[model samples]
Target: MAEGGIVRVRHCGAAIFCRRAPARCPACGSPLRGAGLPAAPVRLPGPFRHGHRQPRALLLRPAAGTFLGGYDGRSDLHVGVSSSQGVVYNYDEEGVHRAETGWEQCISIPLVQPDMFGLLQQWDKLLEEFSAGEDWLPHRYDEHDHNCYTYALAFVNSVLTAQGKQQMSKSEFTERFVIPRTKQASRYLTLHQELTAKDFYIVPLPDGENQG
Candidate 1:
């Protein structure tokens, strides 16, 4: 696999999207010696009509600790995050959608920098503090070009917080993320409408980006 890429796992006759790394597998009992992370839009447990569209959001692996999925070509909004450890997760639109955890339960968190749950917790509160709050996340997601925006931003800020690259009040964070998304929605939405479900995925291979 390339330095930052994902691969799909054919586990128990099912596919799972995983973040790629140079060493070990975060999913099942395995190592990444020759393994890679799968691409997005994978078929996992979901609420929507799922056949093979890129996920709106990805949930964190209990082992990967504090991370989630990444971008796909289908998204109007896009981001690529890489940790110093060479771990990478692509946050695309659909992956974001799949990342939902209802009011009562939440995913297990790992020892992440800055904070994973903290940012999520903060955003949850910020949404309540805002004017248009009902299903605000789903709306903001629709306004953007992809589904992965919420958690991607979370990943970015968490990485930044860990690295001391940036900081912001809740308003500042919202201002920074929302403006670009609202503005760029016109650009990526058409792409989103055109691409089908299969368009978002690719098995991460050694130097895979250069191949067909």
Candidate 2:
């Protein structure tokens, strides 16, 4: 596993690789590493990471799994709740199948921290938007992208309402999750974007937001 519990896809030559396994290269019977090939700034995810957005921009990230959901304090203030429609149900056969009967799920994860501040920022350079300077210093970068998919927020009110702790209100809900007016220069720098936040969060996830 990685230093943290972050597990991501790796590429070796023309093949994709994974760090933990039983997983083998589809082309060869070898283990994988996230750093298997080249690591480029363009390879890095997020323009926000490139100093794009104004600071105080809090982002949200969602936590998603195949069959279950749980709380993760290791993440930002927001918690995300999501469900997937299995690819097995789609008849087009265009989706890649991990197994014969199992369908790949496209899960929607939300982040309530700020721009480029969650797991989705860990995007493939060939697959994602580019940012400069992440490579100019040669410091090791967090593989996790400052994005929403991995840094999803579950919303303080969303969880409470679902758990019967906080009553649901349209006004209260909207006020809590929408974008805020604050520091406009330092949002979405790395993992745990919430840690640097000094203001109240307007997390969008229903069960998202609470300072630890």
Candidate 3:
């Protein structure tokens, strides 16, 4: 898989998108390996979904009505953690809630490998306890500072602490893990917007750019 949580496979001399690095391209059944990162955005199959059946993942999605689906980094987002059973634990104005729906609308960053059985066991329990804690009371939900992002980071730090690892601040985690994926998504959205508007979008390059 390439960086930014996307797998780019060369198919018919063009790149196609997948989240996992499959042995064969999902679109054409061709062997997929060492295709390298894509130079342009390609349409993914269906909507951009993640977190379903992905255990110990940090889930992210644009909040309702966000322009360009919040991949532009200028809008608010809803965040959550996924459990072994694909349930999402998140906080909002209504406080902590375990959700069985909405994973199909998210993009995920895996926080732990699935083979870590001991840690996976602890993850669900810790998530439950953290969600029920008093710091996440509905009355305390602050849109700008103490909302979903805060709650998600706190839970991630709790997991780090449990594993005797250094805990991460919100900015650290976001920069190190989240922003890359969002930037990839933003590129796709920008291309999609251009295609929707004009049916074709050409890259604007300086003189002699990429002329080999």
How big is the positional error of residue 80 in model 3, measured in Å on the Cα after superposition?
Answer: 0.9
Per-residue alpha-carbon lDDT of model 1 for 1-212, expressed as tens digits? 12113334443223434333223333344553444333222222321111112122222221221111223323343332222222333343233222222211112112234445564445433322331333224434543443343444555455456556775554675575444443343333222332223333222445434221
Q: Which ten residues in a row have the lowest lDDT in candidate 1?
A: 102-111
Q: What would the TM-score be for candidate 1 when compared with the true structure?
A: 0.21
How should the candidates be ordered by TM-score, best one leading? 3, 1, 2
Please identify which of the two predictions, 2 or 3, would achieve the higher TM-score against the true structure.
3
Tens digit per residue, CA lDDT, model 3, 1-212: 11244434454444444454456654456565554443333435322455667778888877664333334556667888888788988899998888887666566788888677888778888888889899999999999889998999998898888889999977899899998878766776665554445523345344544221
Runs in model 3 deviating more than 4 A are 1-47, 65-73, 204-212
Best-matching candidate per lDDT = 3
TM-score, prediction 3: 0.71
Ranking by lDDT: 3, 1, 2
Scored by lDDT, model 1 comes in at 0.33
Measured against the true structure, the TM-scores of the candidates, in listed sequence, are: 0.21, 0.17, 0.71
Q: Lowest summed lDDT over 10 consecutive residues: which window, candidate 3?
A: 1-10
lDDT by residue (45-143, candidate 2, tens digit) is 222121112112222222233111222424333212221211111111122111222212212223224453332343222111222223211232223
lDDT of 2: 0.26
All candidates: CA RMSD (Å)? 15.7, 23.1, 8.1
